[model samples]
Target: MTQSLSPLKSFSPDSGQVKVWIRRLVWKMSIATFLLMAIGSATRVMNAGLACPDWPLCYGQFVPTQQMNLQVFLEWFHRLDAALIGMSAIALVGLSVWFRNVLPRWLPWASGFALFLIVFQGILGGLTVTELLRFDIVTAHLGTALFFFVTLLTIGACLSDFQGNNTANKLPWIGLTAASLIYLQSLLGGLVASQWALHQCFFRGDMCIVMNTHIIGVVPAALATLAAIVISWRTAALHPLIRTFANIALVLISSQILIGVATFKLHLQVAPLTVTHQAVGAALLGSLTLLTVFALRDRQSSGQYPASKLT
Candidate 1:
């Protein structure tokens, strides 16, 4: 008689060391992704987008030998940093694929997708500079980075060993709804940044001007996120991972709003804070996307739980 392999043995948990290494790799990639986005935003804030005035190089020099000019240095340094991050991302993809048996299947795909997007984003960045920082291309570049950020977060969550209860399946819908709203808000924020619309409502001579219309859209978005948090918390049937992510989204969204108000009240002169606001928005979007993925995963894994309820 032929022996049949047991399903239980087939789906056994990965070894502790393998899980640890996967987590470490995910963390490294996350940090690199954040740094990449931050540097790109800094380049914009410093108005160094066209300092080098060349694609993939600074003033026809591979290393930018001239360090006396601050703009040229900043622009060149940003490019160098970008190259390093790209290499790191490639390494991450290799690691994920090499350890695919122990790691989640989605992790490798996410890393590969991110790598492709980064290349595309690089092309967009080059076009932005070569075209004198055309608004459309610049905005598209930012959008692409946002996509990569969310993908990285999803991969990180998948690699984690956290498993939610089977009772939490019903809450996946809530998580999906909240994620959709957060994404929409994030896209709107990107539009605002790309269009340079933050100052649209502000008249040069008007002091104590009302920003009601400009800030109105944020209210609904914030409310939807808040509702999701409350639902996740109150629903004892929800998974802890989902609840944790929901709470984080709530906190980040609140902070983002405060930063937005501060940016407006300070007459938008605070470059660092403005960039920070953008970063927080990106982080929130990424976290929510991961939360959605985790919630769905939990629903699928719920079947592994015992059929008898634990009193």
Candidate 2:
């Protein structure tokens, strides 16, 4: 006769279920990171980065009572959201370690890297405030945040269950190239905003060289984005959801370009438009990232298909 099954063995979820939960958690974290980016862009546009004038606390407390204002609220809430993401990142690392036996081979390493990045991101945030928003530090801070967001996006894609027919599509490389170009442009954009170069160029027309650099950067970025969309559409094996995201990248980048033109034309006078442009830029980056990830996953499936299927 067989021995009775152990309680722990009997109650534990199957490998598939554990993977599903991990994927869901990663997706949630990605969404939180996306929203955090939007809030961050808004905070910068509002000129409220120093609303708290302190790190890990506002007005030397968990919350600021004496300095409560709209700017303070925006800054405080941004920090709060970041802290939440940090806690979630740590939790993710913990869960991945605990369930390393059940997770995919790559997830644990990625999770650990994410944890490190978030810790670094928190330190950068502090430096942005404490150092009085030096242009280089602020640019680095934004760069770190974007990197963190991209990490979560990758983790989410790895844990995703979306699958379609795997095909020999060469579009994945194109997507990767496009995404990288866009990311470079994003860093430049961040620099433009942080250094007040955009305002200087738009209003005073003094910093034309930097503005011209940004303008030239947009051409390659747009071309790459267009190629990614077109290539995605041509690749029949790509999942429908991935195609949808590629289409979204096209839309967002288009809107971003238009808004960017408007921002310059209007001399950065319209606050909402400028802020929306920044948010849309981030969204564009995210969509392209997802598209690239899904495409790569499909490519992998075309080879020796793993037991753990994408769909």
Which segments of candidate 2 are over 4 A away from where they belong?
1-10, 203-205, 303-311
| Candidate 1 lDDT for residue 210 | 28
Model 1, which residues run further than 4 Å from truth? 1-19, 68-70, 99-107, 200-214, 303-311
lDDT (Cα, tens digit) per residue for candidate 1, span 190-294: 555555565664654332122343466677777777776777788766666677778899889899999988987886678898789778877777667766777
Candidate 2 lDDT, tens digit per residue, 65-158? 7889989999999999989888988888888888888888888889999999989988989999989989888888888888888888888887
TM-score of the candidate numbered 1?
A: 0.80
Q: TM-score for each prediction?
A: 0.80, 0.92
